[model samples]
Target: MRGFGELEAAVMEHLWAFPDGATIPQVHERMQADRDIAYTTVMSTVHNLHRKGRLTRVREGRKHRYRTTASRAEHSAELMREALGSGGDPRAVLSHFVERIDPADSRRLAELLATMEEPPR
Candidate 1:
């Protein structure tokens, strides 16, 4: 969301929520239900997302249906990775991040790490 403006974020959120892809009109309708927005605005936002490689679109009959190229979790992970890569000792960054997480999340992270360390079956 940090990398996108208001309209762009709304469009991306809608596409991610709909996974099956939606036409510009569908996205516009959803946005309209939430607040006032123009059809051309949704159309341009989706086209921009597609051009930026954040979304993919396919022509479905007379309409182009758009969907997220990456899931929300994947995008979040990428953002985290980018943050870690930004001029810091990766170990320290990870340690600080892990230290701040809640106990439940820490336990889950440990369990995931343990599972990752196991040899493949």
Candidate 2:
């Protein structure tokens, strides 16, 4: 899958922020408040995200409201997983990552690993 450009990431951030989803005008309006952005550019970005399976949309009257198909955390995790599996030594990659994380995150990761080892309820 092609990586997202700045505008694409911004659009996705807006959709993720608005769980109910947002129309192109809504996103464009918010973005334009910060900087000049063309409505068509936002529209095309949302359409591209939808086509890439990163977003889902539904028609509401004359407009389409878009939402992310996966939560940000899930999307990030998938990216990490893909990178780990991408012809590199997974163990080394993970070890290097773990070694670089802060102590708090390391502790949290340990806790999560412990929880995963628990039997199903």
Candidate 3:
């Protein structure tokens, strides 16, 4: 899978904030508070997200309430894993990634890694 575009990202952020789910009109209304956007644009974006399998929808009266297939954190982890497997040496990529992070984050990562159980063969 690929990352979201500008408008798509905005829509996803709004949807993520609504854990229960949101309709196109609801998302469009919230987004209009920040920027000038058309309702149809929001509608199309949400529909495209559903087509991409990023979102699921259920009929709510006359509108469809949409929800993300995964949580925001899960999506971020998937992106990280995708990047890690993209190319070249995994260790080298990880080493560079570690080097770029702040000390606190590095320490936190180390702690988490230490606590994690190894996957079964």
Highest-TM-score candidate: 3
1-121 per-residue lDDT for model 3 (tens digits): 6789999899999999998999999999999999999999999999999999999999989999999998899999999999999958999999999999999999999988977866756
Relative to the true structure, how large is the alpha-carbon lDDT of every model? 0.88, 0.86, 0.94
Better of 1 and 2 by lDDT: 1
lDDT per residue (tens digit) for residues 2-116 in model 2: 3568988888888888979888899998889888988889888889888889888898998888888888888888888888888489899999999999999999999999999
* RMSD to true structure for each model, in Å: 1.8, 1.4, 2.2
By summed lDDT, which 10 consecutive residues of candidate 2 come out lowest? 1-10
- State every prediction's TM-score relative to the real structure: 0.91, 0.93, 0.94
Clashing pairs in 3: none
Quote the lDDT for 86 in model 3.
97
TM-score of 1: 0.91
Model 1 stretches with alpha carbons more than 4 Å out: none
Question: In model 3, where do residues sit more than 4 Å from their true spots?
Answer: 118-121
lDDT of 1 by residue, 1-121 (tens): 3367888988888888896989999999899999988888889888999888998888999998888888989888888888888848999999999999999999999999999999989
